[model samples]
Target: LLEYLEKDSFTKDEILAIKTEDAGLTEHLEAIKQAYGFGYDSISELIEELEGYLKSLNERLDYYLNIDFDGRSVVGDDPDNLDDRDYGDNNVMPKNGSIHGTHVSGIIAAVRNNGLGSNGAANNVKIMAIRNTPNGDEYDKDVALGVYYAVDNGAKIINMSFGKSFSPHSDWVRDAIAYAAKKDVLIVAAAGNDSKNTDEGQYYPNDQIGVGEEVGDTFLKVGATTYDYGSGIISGFSNYGKSSVDVFAPGSRIYATVPDGKYRFLQGTSMASPLVAGIAALVLSQYPKLSAAELKQILMNSGLPVVKKVSLGDDAVVPFSELSKSGRLVNAYNALIMASKISR
Candidate 1:
């Protein structure tokens, strides 16, 4: 808020008046006082600490508000039009040359044993790039159409590694998910990297309109996990909830291919989501008769259980089982075995 005022050239007295009159700021400052009472020995010191925190948020908001890149002209479509689906061309590459999509693709199906970077989660798979999400928030129309394109183009499993806090046109994406469900296509999505409980504040493009009320049975929301299977197994930044996130998967320090024919290590629920998507693809490949619903069930039910306490956002400790609905970390071998039994 302070940064925005400075950006718009507000005077000192104006800023002071706005701060003094802002009810939301007063409520937030009071909440902060309650959350960290007397930590700084007095109210003045606490106010000073809170001012720093507000400055951090101000800077972040200003950064996002000032991004110069515009990707709308590349696709050449009316972003507000839900019916304008025949817009994007064959070019699926990132506008800014970001390697995020490439990294996720490699994590799902990089070629194995050719003396390259590393083997992907699946052996044989075909990739379809939608390229809708950009550096920041994506349009709802684009996301909805992307799902439609994938399902229509013979994509049996769709991997979505992007999410945002708000979705003004959530129904469009929700309908697209339902369309995928009708076609027996499974969707694997990241639960976001906010480290907050999704049940309390949702990440968009989810299967649920409200918590626990699922729109489709084929959608899987995956959370990130660390290599450590101990009390701190949950990734420090991975969003979680027993009612929102479906499963956990290894995401921290993941090695995969990047653009320009290079490879690197990265981490997020983005990586974790594709790992599960790759597993789903592998299971479907081996058990061709399995339906999308069955495949989702197999992945969820076959994972290795983690029943210990896990450290979540900030310093809150909760049972690992409370992190995701399945209370398990995705296991490829176990999923394949479970698929075999179900197929038989």
Candidate 2:
């Protein structure tokens, strides 16, 4: 509240009036607090309560408000780019109304600061949209080609915002991930959207390459985050893994581009991956010489930690430290701080 007041135009008198109007404001604030923390008794009850709360909040919150970027027409229907590029069937073209890709694209680089939409985390970036992911599970060939295509076309960072729990030829995708790692291109992926721990064989395409105590430095699988920090450890439905999922970001109720030149609120690790990708883009943009491994270290090392203990599949609040590889949430502010030191 103090932070909000300092940044916004809320004068002393206006704030006084608000405080006066809501006699129980402090009481309510203390209850839900930082993350709308709840003390439910059962998982079903928790889901029931969270679903309604999230749905209602989605109607009002602009999930993409934080990232700085503007929308562009790469293929399907960007009015600004009048026939700039053909979105052929052979090549997965950008859908004018596909909200998911548009949102992810906006997060990566949507024409920074044009006085239109929000600015992307990175100031300088050239987003190459390879539309391989469809409504359902994506094909292994498509995903493989997507990674190779990005590498061949000079794409330093590839943001894969889609995945599935089942794949016929899983090795193909794994090899694609490996290929990206070998080529020195950073591949940030979404740890599926199941809200369960992927370490349990539940998380397909799971990043358990090294297993034991150390994970390979090539891939960074991310879980989605909600608005608050405390009891809101992970999204109500985000899959968690002790060592698989690297970190978390705001994926609760993201506001981003949609098909038909419109915008709306959508949820998934799909949304979170782009958020991280955009931040990585910013880091690379500032220090263009940083390798993919260096970039990943910067991200993990600079993230913000959640102090409050919270539950993972139940109401038993465990220390935030017990969650993922890094007990911290993705913090762009901290990332820049660390990146500056590294750049020097």
Candidate 3:
């Protein structure tokens, strides 16, 4: 980084080119400027600031990785205790300025026809913000409690766009799923971004007990799909399974909201889950009497069928139908039509 920055001077275009090379460096430079003044008087000053910033960033990263930095000590509750709901505050907003939840929320219910960013999938949707995820892996107890809170507070459709590979106490989550099912609430979860078959693996917060065994019919697992309708339709990063994942949804390069009242394009099953959730919300709004299980089935069965073989990852290809249980891409129009027919 020093070698790249070592120069007599830098033009605006050259600075922009350097910033484009790394997102972290760009943010660091912006932060430095915000702390100090706007423009640096000399290249040496800029280089000095960047060197210190890089050193601090590396040290912080090393500490985070090598040390067992536990933030739960401040929360004052044991992670093992599911009944200990006395911790946490009412701040359901994103912590540490994370835009993941913001992007997911916008994908579902951003204002329509306002010329702000883009039109969301659903119009008449009431979003309930649940801040359970931190910077890294979330706790199983928090996952359970978040679901319970959503269900109890009249959340008809819950979109969990986050997942981890390991969950020591997944039973808590599964029990929450059963509770949501009994209350007739639909859960839409991301299939994960691991680029592996979930049938042969496990993703946390899933409703499945085994490959073919599911706890309830209200759970829908969604895989990520690209805008391509051809062989490369399936996103290479998406996790898939014939029995695990329920459907595919557009996730690649999805434009939505970000932190600090901004908008940007992001890609993942995280983006896909909320898109599916929005579609589910649209269906449910029109047909309020439909059960969550029926809603799940309608979404799975009414998606757009893909007849072509698609790329999974690493030059590997499989029939699109084999990737997920439904073997179809979630379509809002088709879902609404199916819901109307079912309502009839």
Candidate of highest lDDT: 3
**Total clashing pairs in model 1:** 0
Report the C-alpha lDDT of model 2 over 15-90, residue by residue, as the tens digit.
4344434546665344433232433333344455467446534532332221232222333433233223344356
Q: For model 3, how does the per-residue alpha-carbon lDDT over 39-142 read when each residue is reduced to its tens digit? A: 34445655654674466346445432434766678889888999888999888665553677888999999998998997788997898998886654478999
Query: Positional deviation of 64 in candidate 3, in angstroms?
Result: 10
After superposition, candidate 3 runs with Cα above 4 Å error: 1-67
Each prediction's Cα lDDT score? 0.83, 0.67, 0.84
- How much is 171 displaced in model 1, in angstroms? 0.4
Decoy 1 TM-score against native: 0.79
Best first by lDDT, ranked: 3, 1, 2
Backbone clashes counted, model 2: 20
* lDDT agreement of model 1 with the native: 0.83
Find the candidate with the highest TM-score and give its number.
3
Instruction: Mark the regions of model 2 whose C-alpha exceeds 4 Å error after superposition.
Output: 1-90, 94-97, 209-216
Backbone N/Cα/C clashes per model: 0, 20, 0
RMSD of 2: 11.2
How far out, in Å, is residue 3 in model 1?
37
Judged by TM-score relative to the true structure, which candidate is superior, 2 or 3?
3
